[model samples]
Target: MVTTRQGVRLLGPGDVDAFLDLARRDPVANVFAMYRARTTRLEPRWLGGEAWGRFHDGELVAACHVGANLVPIESREEDARAFGERALARGRSVSTIVGPTEAVREFWRTVSDSWGRPRDLRWNQPHLVIDGPPTAAPDPGVRRTMRAELDELYPACVAMYTEEVGVSPEVGGRNDLYRTRVAQLVSRGWSFARFDAGRLVFKAEVACATDDAAQIQGVWVPPDRRGEGLAVAGMAAVVELVRAEIAPRVSLYVNEWNEPARRAYARVGFQETTTFSTIMF
Candidate 1:
């Protein structure tokens, strides 16, 4: 258990192993992986409280962060206290707080009254856990097809993501931060989608995965063709590929308020395992 103060140095691959240990208790490994990957890629100035943890006796017991998320640690409540202090000292105002729902709630409870509350958004995202037996493989079936030729897909994916998040996905070269994960997925046998109409309108991506799980992200249908519910079939195609190529567990994030998106996901066999929140002000 490393002491809380020593963890002031928590960033980069230093905390990778410990973080993975904590994620083991989590249903989806990708949730943690995506953020970790972002940390490595952006090297975002360690912007103070960039990462925080509370460990006891040389083991990480609790952790949190400020980045793609404000992940408050709950496995150890004391760490959350330490993390909040560190974040405030840095004069930080993060874009969002994304983490285990309850952990996030507790974090907010501490500062909401003082720093003022950000917009509260709940997630109804569902995760597909691997069942007792392996599922059947896709024939033409399941596959994660990375596009070497479709340079056009990036903008389209950005559009889809913006629509999904209700904010524009970064259009400037700024979002290149995600390219590493994109490339990582491609290298690790991840799948992205292309429509038969010859447009790169639909795709599936994973933020993180391992032998036991392969969490997914970036599922989208183009705005021009959304009414057709193309996202469902497209996601199904991706799910089959995930089932075949990646780990058995395939998961995705859906905004809690987005009923149509939730319905589409449930129709494809996803079930809500828990709630999560992404606080953005």
Candidate 2:
């Protein structure tokens, strides 16, 4: 008979494989965590925070990525509660707590009082994914963004971020960091957009990826172009390019209150697989 040693501990580089194996249990849903794990390789210096794991029988079962964003991976209510306790003790260092709905809720319940009130609580974000070809016709004009077009794209990005997050990315003097992030995505050929007569119309970027999936972020259509089917066709084009080069599956999450955005994604053949929640500071 084998005895199980159950506890939560801070994971390190040596735990990378175990962490990844746990994440792959639901690749599309866990894409963000997996991407961070792969990129940072469980190094605290690179992670800028820490990764915590819950174990049973000396085997990893659930993990949490604690950084600027607190993301729980395959965590049950109990696991999330425990992670939340740890987070509370460490103090609220993250700007956001996001992940599967139940886990995020449980985690938040654990830390909410100590963490203080968040700027926003998004409790019903639909987590959507697409594997096969997009249903809508791809827009021929929608293509990878060129580095030279950064000047054109930067404004739209700022607009989108400010609208979605309720604050300018430049707040707290993060203008350079945010701009550099946009450029990095463009340099990696992950930014996509459609422009008309030198005016940017639609745009999005693959925020992160793993061998199995990629998560799209910053999806936006200029206010003037919102009802012109630009987003549907533009996203279709992005799906084609992303599937052809990045990962086989594409995923994204949208706020439940945004019915128009939700409908557009549905038309593009994305189906909601789960719900996610975010508590943003």
Among these predicted structures, which one has the highest TM-score?
Answer: 2
Report the lDDT tens digits of candidate 2 across residue range 141-199: 99999999999999999999999999999999999999999999999989999989988
Q: What's the lDDT for candidate 2?
A: 0.93
Please report the TM-score between candidate 1 and the true structure: 0.75
* lDDT tens digits, residue span 155-256, model 1: 666676676666765656657765554567666666477655556656777766666667777776666767675667666666776666666777766676
- TM-scores, one per candidate: 0.75, 0.97
Model 2 poorest 10 in a row by lDDT: 1-10
Candidate achieving the largest lDDT: 2
- Model 1 clashing residue pairs (backbone): 1-56, 1-57, 1-58, 1-59, 2-58, 138-141, 138-142, 143-241, 144-191
